[model samples]
Target: MEFKYSDNDQLSVSSTREKIQEEVFNAKCRVLTEIRECGQLCDVQIRVGEESFPTHRVILSASSPYFRAMFTNSQFVDPNQQVIQLEQVSADTIRSIIRYAYTQQCDISTENVESLLVAADYFNIVGLLSECCQFLASQLSAENCIGIEKFASWYACSELEQIAHNFFMENFVEIYRTSEEFLHLEPENLCRVIASDDLNVKSEEIAFDAIIHWVDFDPIGRTCYMAKLLGCLRLGLFSTYFFVEKVKEHRYVKDNTACRPLIIETLKFLCDLDRYADARSLGNFDISSCMLTPRMPHGILFVFGGWNVNSPTNIIETYDIRSDSWMSCQTAESDYRAYHGTCVLDGLIYIIGGFDGMEYFNSVICFDPVKQIWLEVAPMYSKRCYVSAVILGGHIYAMGGSDGHTRQSTAERYDKNRNQWSFIQPMHQQRSDASATILDGNIYICGGFDGVTILNSAEFYTPEIDQWTLITPMLTPRSGIRVLTYKNTIYAIGGFNGVIRLNTIERYNEKSKAWEPGPEMSTARSNFAIEILDDTIYAMGGFNGHSTISSVEYFDIDNEQWYGAADLNVRRSALSACVLKGLPNAKSYVPSRSRVPIMDASDTVHLKDT
Candidate 1:
């Protein structure tokens, strides 16, 4: 290759010299390293603690702004000065850093990371500073994340500070439970964590407990911070029993004048929740009342592709338990199907076997929540609607459904890695509208119509033997029922009992080997989407024996009853719901929180009027 002079006499490049430039850079680094090691022509000595390192002035100046300013400006350095002293950085840290000035390489690890970050930033070594920050960011954990966040912020490492802060909030529960640094956080940092809408707590009780513990750690120094932190909790969420016995009666809360108003406001909200629920139902409620607003949940519940208003709908939505709201997600353009079954496995949401309108489909669609795109996975062996779907042993099992023409007893499992569906041992009965769940290492499916009869029989399949065993039948001949497994207990609820739509609930007693009656749901409905959120069972939109309804409610085991939740935007029946946990961008699926906790609860109230 050659270069030539242009008409204007400027040299023009004829070929790329990228490879040659890289070799030249490597040669310069090697020669510099050798010279520094030999101490031949070293112009400066860096003294830290009891050690002095011989270094080249030109090399340090070229590598860092801190050195460049000292060597160039008299205000920073004397021309006759031959040595520099740094009391903040240890000699061991400078040795590696100085070596990096010559070789452009340094060893960074957890042991030396904090020291390296401090020294690298102090010396204004951009490359080394970046490496240290990256290493620290990767090493973020619940045990040390609070320390990392504090240090990163103190050092003005903006990017690392933000990452560490987000990690602390996302893993808040674990950090609070395990991190010793959590108790030592300054009031402002502690306030920020609790006030964040993204704080993940199954119940507000955890937040309440955290503040008490934190304040009690240094009672004299921290008691004054109780008011500031107390406002950060969603106090209206706690029952009156817990509030009076645990919070309102706590010495820190009861004795503090500033916390008294918040305490009173929360009591008002608790007494009037039913009234507020009515107002919220009519769209007249203020969701901005911080005490009433829910914190952002880490897991989002998805309800997609359902039978709505006498027809199939492709509308997709997610239930944010924290906010008690349903928000729509992007839908597949032409893939409207209903009576389908869905499950989340390996981060992809699978919609298997369902009917569109006139035709039954054996197609499978996978939704990539991050990409917001729908992709096709392997289809099932049979076209199915009213299908039973469960994820077991990392495989998605599609069991009996109608397939439009007839009830199918055929079963198949799809392997996502192979992109293939293999036939599995079929169920004993040709059942449609049967609900299935993975319980105790087996696929237990129960209650469905078998063409001529509404079957009360339930059965479980063991993959190891590829066989089905009949369990004792339910006391009632129920079809279209939903079965859920939680804490090793199987709960069966709401369905047609061959005579009428029933909301009666029963749980399978594993020891008794029989279905024992449990508390009934608030609404009697059939063919609804049921899922567990916040450790409770929420049953969404379905038929109420007359027409389709949009009512939603959750059953609380401790209270032994169902409570109303936000209703669906549109009426739905034969819908499928799946719980998608630990979504990286969970906020994208849930409602955006505009306000934090009870600061507004106290501000908007006039307690004296009472």
Candidate 2:
């Protein structure tokens, strides 16, 4: 295929090559000029197949976007120094990024990530940098994150650093923990990383020490100690020793480590559960010291579980609206348990399964306030503790519960007439200490423990198919959280965050199928009780991080917020409550602990209805 070269052909080929080289040279000059003259730091260059952006341009522009943007118009350039390789990003992607840079509202497709990131970092566009950081965090991977690591470090992107910390924390054991590459990271950053499996505590300690020393050199104190602490707690590496060491030296924490009177007041308030008779001011209604209960009974308000002292009682008390007092109606027909579930149907108070210190009970028992007797019904197939139960469509649905050792996904239904237990489809996730409530023909379950971890995911039960369908997860992962339905929406309130109790509240929108952030409780807690009266959702006693609270408060669901309410008389959890369907008597309706049956004395006492 050899042919003699003609002078005209030779000149034409030479001219084409020179023209290509000239275009490359011009792109390089544009990037350098933007950086040196315009103060735009970007490494923009054209990338052609198998070609390298000139070495001079690579060195001069380095990681800046100015040099990278030159390739926006040229289809042919060097590949190695393109900033984003020609093979990876399409021409349209580059165009979109260029558009986004000039106009704030332009849509930048995901394919333009590299160019946008380079531009964001190089130009010092803080807003764009944060947005890119968030976007990158969402699509993070070991491969992609590795490439972006150097850029993140060069630009001092604290947000990206946190994002990396979270990603590593969740996937450390699976992807990065054993890798030599990640193992070489600074001790502090290493500590910030998370692993779902087991934490490398010793490695974390080493990193934490290094960070403390390095942070000492930081005068402005930009380092995030709280974020690091949360990371440690999430990874299950936090302990009394870690807390002592960190709290003693960290600058972020408040000086007062000792408990105050307010703390005690908070504990009292949470322990009150839903008995708000004694509440005078917001101060007494301490909002902090309790966890949210998965089981919250309507109308009953506070149903006192047996005391927590050495002599725990099997007594289950109910707060009656007509009486306005707390009284132990009768010992639970089943076992003496804390964290048991109680729900009221018709005139009977149903105390479902819970733990009795040694064992979890699936036994279902009902008590009649009028008959003054407890009757045992069919027991659930699986024994559960820290469980939640809800009545939907005239049937009782029992969700997740622990077997005193492991969480159970299995659920069951109780037929009122037949007095028997039947199995229902299990939930997607096994969770104990979760909350369930009826809303719009669906039972919404939120926040619970699955033996090893707290869950943020939620699901709904459709009575039509008798199946559980997954829904959007809550914003926070929690266990021992309580949920209530008011105004057709479900409110999730107060729960343990493993490290401490929380006061954060959120709700589920049936129409949207999403959880929206809601008002935070005055006191952080778990194992608390929430009830709705009129327009207000009352949050009663439960345990906070350090202790229990007698605090009570209410939230205006319609307003999407909360405010303090009257405190309860006693600090109690694991109580039962029911809306007082007041008898048609002439008078004498006061809130009390004992529930009076809606029937008259002449009504027959059927064992099934007890």
All candidates: TM-score: 0.68, 0.45
Off by over 4 Å in 1: 1-188, 202-206, 234-250, 257-293, 330-334, 594-610
Model 2: per-residue Cα lDDT over 1-610, one tens digit each: 1112225456668889999998887676566545534535444543445543323343333333554454333554444333545554445544443433433323544676667766666544455666777777787775455445645766787768655644544344334523444534554654444322122222234334434444455524525443443334321122223434553345633342342332333334333532433323334432221111011112344353532433234644444322223444433333466677777778766878876666668877776655445667678888977878988767788888888667889888888766668988899999898989988788888889887888999998887897888888899898979898877878888888778788887878888877888878778868776666533566777776665556666665555556654455556555444444322221222322122222111222111100
- In order, candidate lDDTs are 0.82, 0.57
Could you tell me the TM-score of candidate 2? Answer: 0.45
Worst ten-residue run, lDDT, model 1? 601-610
Judged by lDDT against the true structure, how good is candidate 1?
0.82
For each of the candidates, give the backbone clash count: 0, 86
Tens digits of per-residue lDDT for model 1 on 1-610?
Answer: 1111123112123123655777898999999888888999998899988898888888999899999998999998896788898887887899989988888889998889889988988989999988888999999999988888888889899989988988887788778877789989989988988888778776678887778778878999999988889888877667666778888999998889988888888887776664443433425445576776778786789888777886898788888776567887643332688888998989988888888788888888888777677777667778998999999999999999997779989899988756789998889999999899878889999999989899888999999999999999887777778999977899888889778888898889878898889988879989999999767888998888999888998877766777787788778898888887767788788766653222222222111100
Clash count, candidate 2: 86
Q: Quote the RMSD, in angstroms, for model 1.
A: 10.5
